[model samples]
Target: MKIKRAFIGLSVLCAIMLCSCSRTPGGIAPAGSPNGQASSQLPTATPASGSSDLSQSSRPDASTATSPAKPPALTQESIQIKLKQMTANEKIGQMVLAGIDGTTMNAQTKALIQDYQAGGIIFYKVNLANTRQATELINSLKDTNSRNSTPLWLSLDEEGGRVSRLPDELHKFPTNAVIGQANNEKFSFAAGSTIGLELRAYGLNMDFAPVLDINSNPNNPVIGNRSFGANAKVVSRLGVQTMNGLQSQSIVSVVKHFPGHGDTSIDSHIDLPVVQHDLNRLRSLELVPFAEAIKNKADAVMVAHILLPKIDATNPASFSKTIITGILRKELGFQGLVISDDMTMGAIATNYELGEAAVKAVLAGVDVILVGHEYEKEVKVILALRQAVKDKRISMDQLNTSVTRILTLKSKYGISDQKITEPNVAKLNAEVDKVMKLIQ
Candidate 1:
């Protein structure tokens, strides 16, 4: 039973959503902080106290959490419509997701959520070891959202094959490469349909899927068969089918590794890789699926970690405006959420300071930052973001826009409509059958 002490309870869920340095099995505390108060703006994060699986989620003490300000009471629809009218911090909170792993929240994670008002929470493998246990853990996360009257974007990387995090009982669709080998559009649709149908059964709303990478580099260490194909045309055509199938089931799909990870020999999990290809080459091969997916109105776009000399000379795709805003946003016309791949990875981890990257990412136009793996790192990142706003490195208006999109997603998925409850075992098995039939 991995477990850790949560962040201090004094954190208001709204303000706790700030920045922190990286840590595993660590809690987020400010430098020189005593009794949960950071002496200054920059707080040194503390390591989580629990076993690896039990990262600090938020303050476990429910009594100390600050009362919500009168948020002009309105129906769920109005809450969504009124989202645009929220403060910049509120909006930014919607884009930031924290990590949660437990039968229930600990004090520190609760404090972080209640303090910072994070946008969402991501579950790791340790969080899903057993189906019944996972259901309870998810219930705590959902309860946190209900208390705050905010929509929680509870997310998981449940892609089948190598990345499946859900239990064996859940429907596991075939990997993209299997379908790519078939190169059949219907197969692509079937895979996505199966994935989407199964996810909805668990009350999950967002999926980080449909890898747009072309898998051109046979020796690719990170994303081999995870991609659809080696050829851009095949990737683009099948990607469209898969994305359509996902949306048909009402599950929001994100087509990822923008500006591409198709030809990289190195994995971003350890180090940042360079694309080295020219713009024309990128457009013809790597750009096809992304361009097609955006045109199809994909819900979100996950940026890659690699550097592209032809696209941006200064930073990697995650922080490059030339690639994200100039190319992906302006040129391709993608108006949905633009997310950076996990910031705690070696790619971004080795290059920039956590706080620095957090500020720059928002400035560069990414709508969300995925940093759930390392809790201490997440705190430092969030704290740095707050400091950046104070210093005007990141504009308050931009933060608001980011948060607005998150709220819109929450409303669109109707996450608040249903409580996250464990399905009866018999019914759950039937769900697996239903999805299999849809895909088969």
Candidate 2:
């Protein structure tokens, strides 16, 4: 797999450009400030039932020099120009990551790309029947979406253990815990590269892997073995190596469950997990690996649904501008794509309607919202975003910033001059077997 030559031109074009940045409207107020509220200058947003209103949330002070320096703009030619060319529906489509019903390109799949113009497609186990079928399906999705000249991300949650979506015919390696236990950074790099090689062979680009969440809580239901280890230092070191390995093979690595999911006892998929730790505690532990991933220039970071009440009480991190924009974008200074954890998950879906959740996420500074499964709900999200943009509820500046990052990532890793090729199951499995030995 190789980076499309066309994207190299964009690299130079955006070299001098910078990502959109500013203090989120109302920066975080000081401790013991009146009512423990955000600055009065910030716009007030009423939180949903059982949600914290934006004004009531505790946000970081953007003025402090504690935040890292900002990264370069992900695009050139002003993403606004691209936005202007697109219809409101098209722009809305750019924000969605749609899921297909099956491994084949049926009518629903065709409608999603051709009609909906979805910016990306995420595959689950139900969509990977066999090597040939999966390859053809991915190519078909790409071909159909290419009609508009905008590439789509063929993504999957392939974290190499229980999280991997590929069938048994494809290789499956040890979990993150096993890899970390090996204590060899080189092995971790090889594991990530091997996964990338298999994904690339099938024409997929984006991989949501290298779970950056530190396994700090042993009782955590979802992240147990999936995490690298309980040590933040080990996770940071191994996570960066894995990210490098994936990008090295042209597979965009999305370091995930941002701000840390490993410490929570409840799974976000079933219920909202609240991390009671204050910002200082997060910086000391859970946030360490993510900071390292950002420092390594991770291509994308997947924000979790967990709420950090100590930081922002009213909204989950995925729906908080204070967390996404103020902290993730401004404080950490990540210029790469910021994708939301699946919107269909319980933490979000149970609390907010599809349209409401989709709108809030975009407004909160997310680039891509993954509406996995349920086409009806997916359509609702698209229409909601379209309506929001048309009504001016979602600003052009916000849309431009997100679409630029999405397009830049696509331009950088989504494009490929090569055609879909058959994966080497033997070679891939062999690598996994050898790597498994080290961990075993």
Candidate 3:
């Protein structure tokens, strides 16, 4: 009887050991265990809302899971940090927006990017041939600038009527005069949007456009058809709409010839034209559109070479601290970028030495000096700016402020050095056709 009882006890002990062996080591089932009985018996976690039901093998392990890091936000502090890292030459480069000679990238252009580190390039009829050629040239320029710290502003006048610089293949819209005559806000907006769209399609990011100068002077030689209209109210209303439209397409529209270029009898491209208006006169007529533009958040204002002697007795608007910093910035309260009209224009070139004028413009709060001609002149202007900074003619604080503005604008416009594919002329034209219909 004792032996039989001992045998039963041993048999029961062996059965218990066999049951334990059937389970996985940690009281969990091996995934493919027979009948999946152990797995079926295991407790299941309820899935959270909007979460997919994941199997144990597919779920990420908390210990090893990781998330992608986000890029730092662009802010004043971040910009300051970037500014701190830039060299004097790089900072100076940010202030120059130059023009090249050829239709394609050449040694001079390459040096501008690699050596001078020019901030921007404005293309003209000389630099464009056909759609494909222009696109290739622009892409090449961008490719060359890829190694540089900041992107180039591939820009053109492209104001649609007489001032357009687009390739022959692209369709041209009516002049600002025609659009202003139409006096249709919707049509004006569409026009600006269409222009911006085509410009962006060609990888050009800036348009020196929407001549805010009211065609007040019937005999104004330079701004004849360029002005929106003779009436300030009309210019103001349509100008703002056009500006908004261009901005809609992510193109920076530079409202030009600020403090008004409408009343000048002489073409500023040839000689300096004086605006005899005092502050009150400007506030009433000439400054109406500009004031309105500023109220509507103008991105940039191009100061003309036209001298307002009554306002600043000596320097042209582009070089006058009273006009740029005092009037436009302080009085009009314009905080956006201030660009100078082409320094190579006869008004400036014939009067002031290129280098000296550039320094004066910088000191006067002009953020960008547009040197739209001659490689030699561009180089001289750059060297002059460098020397000025070194000699304390242009203070480091002032330099930083201007560079900060330039970089901030570049950031705002999402400017990049990435190469663009060939533009589809047909597609762009088709869109432009739609806009033309509206204006017509």
TM-score of each: 0.78, 0.81, 0.83
Which candidate would rank higher by lDDT, 2 or 3? 3
lDDT of 3 by residue, 1-440 (tens): 33233323332433354343223111212223232211111111111111122223322221221111111213455457557767899999989999999888899999998899899999999899887889789989887776565678888888878898998887888888988899877777777767777776777879998889988889999998888889899998888877877776667889988878998899988999988889899889988899988888788999999888788989999999999999899999999899999999999989999999999999999999999999999999999999999999999999999998887776556665545567677767776776666655
Which one wins on lDDT?
3
List model 2 lDDT by residue over 129-182, tens digit each.
888788777777765664553567788999978898886796588788888888
Error of 2 at 29 (Å): 50
Count of residue pairs whose backbone atoms collide, per candidate: 57, 1, 0
The list of candidate 3 runs beyond 4 A from truth reads 1-73
**Candidate 2: minimum summed lDDT over ten consecutive residues — where?**
42-51
| lDDT values, one for every candidate | 0.65, 0.72, 0.77
Q: Model 1 RMSD to the real structure?
A: 12.9
Instruction: Please give, for residues 362-416, the per-residue lDDT of candidate 1 as tens digits.
Output: 8899989888666688778787887777888887767766765665554344444
Predicted structure 2, TM vs. truth:
0.81
Look at candidate 2 and tell me the lDDT of residue 344. 90
